[model samples]
Target: MAIRITGTGSYIPSNIEKNEDFNQHEFLNEDGSTINHHNEVIIEKFKAITGIGERRYVENNLNTSDIAFYAAQNAIENAKINQEDLDYIIVGHNYGDVKHNTEQSDTVPSIASRVKHLLGIKNPKCVAYDILFGCPGWIEGVIQANAFIKSGIAKKCLVIGAETLSRVVDKHDRDSMIYSDGAGAVIVEESTEEGGIIAHESATYALDEAHFIYFGKTNHPEITDQRRYIKMYGRKIYEFALNNVPAAMKSCLDKSGYDISDLKKILIHQANEKMDEAIVQRFYKLYKMKMPEDIMPMTINKLGNSSVATVPTLYDLILKGELEGHIINKSDVIMFASVGAGMNINAIIYKY
Candidate 1:
């Protein structure tokens, strides 16, 4: 049996946080005073480097599950399937719901369960759970759904990638601007035809570089808990991406018996524009050919990095014809790849 993505949907919060807002965003010194830097210069430099001018942030009134529920509902509607037909609901996330006032992370009942309840899915047979594998969690969720379908365990499954990363990041830190909030979802169902995920490859480089971007304290230990917020060694992660991501992508293509020429578009993680461009460039070099212009689509400039939500959201836009000059044909091939925290990397190849 073959597995196919029948529908896709995404939700990005309406609230936009511009880079200029960070100027007065309380970047403080140890004793609670401003750390001196030309805020305008920093904002411009950040835009030039990451290609991000603004990103959406969920308001205090909302939670991760809320966004996931919306995305899942939209996906179900798009797939033209009855809600009761869903056999599984798998959510990919890093931090569960975080209560801002209490600074608490809650995972006792999985976010997927809450989403299932809110969707009014009353089927007792529909399994729902969460997965954590750094930024690759969503793709991993899809991979597991594939196993379930191919093994005759499921007929239809909903895979969702949702994150409210702004809640986990220290607004004062330089890395904070790269994180945001959003959710994306897809309906994967058993198909008699052969136009779905053809092949995939993934791996983890368990090293200190893995810790380069992780959940940890603010640099000023006097102010907050030791493992409270997100922090990173940018240079270390940049190096790791350049060294590992392209190889994993190529390995995935090879597994599917494909070459660079076979793919129409490549959707990569929207973490850093500079790094994403570099990774694709390196992947083409492995074939001794240059990547075609406009072959890679990016949303990082506007969406920032919503962790696992990025690629699925990008795919949803393309499918809806919401992106300019980006469209898929009846049998086009595409590749998706990403690398992030865990030093984890993953790739997927599919036909449309």
Candidate 2:
């Protein structure tokens, strides 16, 4: 049984915020006159580093659900499936319009229902709603949907990865360069046809040492309720990505009964440039494998890291000819790999 991605769609905000615009924001500079060299350097370096020139940002009136609706519409249209056929809507997101105490208990059900109503779908049987592993949530959603659809729990499912990470970024902080807003979606259906999610695998490392990405304390004094902003140990994450992501990728491929040469393309998470290079170099040196030149294009440069939306948004660019000259073939197998904040690493093997 194969779960096919019949249609793919993505929505980027119309607002075009360029590098010079970000540089002129004044908050990017530390002391008004003196700018941080690393910050300024990365803004310029990322263009050449990742190949992303611009990313989309929804304005004040828009929310994740709104962007998601647009992407879903496009995917639905592309899939050419009737609305009545959709039995599930899984939204993979970290930040939502409203805050919640736990990741699992967010307003995703309300979101799914709202989207179903907007689409005029007849009594859609929505199921399995929640935010899974932050940036890796999108892949997790697809895997879950695959299981359900294959098990006869669903005939058609819509899996959407949407994020508004810009809301949580501390604009004054240097790490703010990695957060952006966007959404992307795929319509997965039970198909005997080719080109869909084939095999998925997940692995976790329970390391307290690597848990330096968050801003909250385990035991904070006072009756503290706070909106903790994003903080990352970039060097630590880079090291972690280099060490764990490749192993995870290989493990996933092995589980799927595939070899290094069997894959046609690789879409690693759009976190940063340096980490992506490490994985590519390791594959070349150890496995004697050559990654496609366009595999690690600069998506984070314009959009920053749209959390879960990263890979799907980049997929849109490739499919839309914005990322021209990239060789994606009809029967090509692609690998999606990532090292997310939970000290979690995941990889999914797909045929497209």
Winner by lDDT: 1
For residues 19-127, what per-residue lDDT tens digits would candidate 2 score against the true structure? Answer: 5556743343323244546555767765665445665667767777778788889888888988677888888776666332222224645556656766777763555
- Candidate 2: segments with Cα more than 4 A from true spot: 24-53, 98-110, 215-226, 290-292
TM-score of 1: 0.95
Q: Any residue pairs clashing in model 2, and if so which?
A: 50-297, 50-298, 51-298, 52-298
Local distance difference test, candidate 2:
0.70
Residue 289 lDDT in candidate 1? 88
Per-candidate count of clashing residue pairs (backbone under 3 Å): 0, 4
Question: Can you give the TM-score per candidate against the true fold?
Answer: 0.95, 0.85
- Writing each residue's lDDT as its tens digit, candidate 1 over 17-114 gives 98888987656433445667777877788899899989999988888998999999999999999889889999999899986555888887999999
lDDT of each candidate versus the true structure: 0.87, 0.70
Candidate 1 error regions (>4 Å) = 28-36, 220-227
Highest TM-score, which number?
A: 1
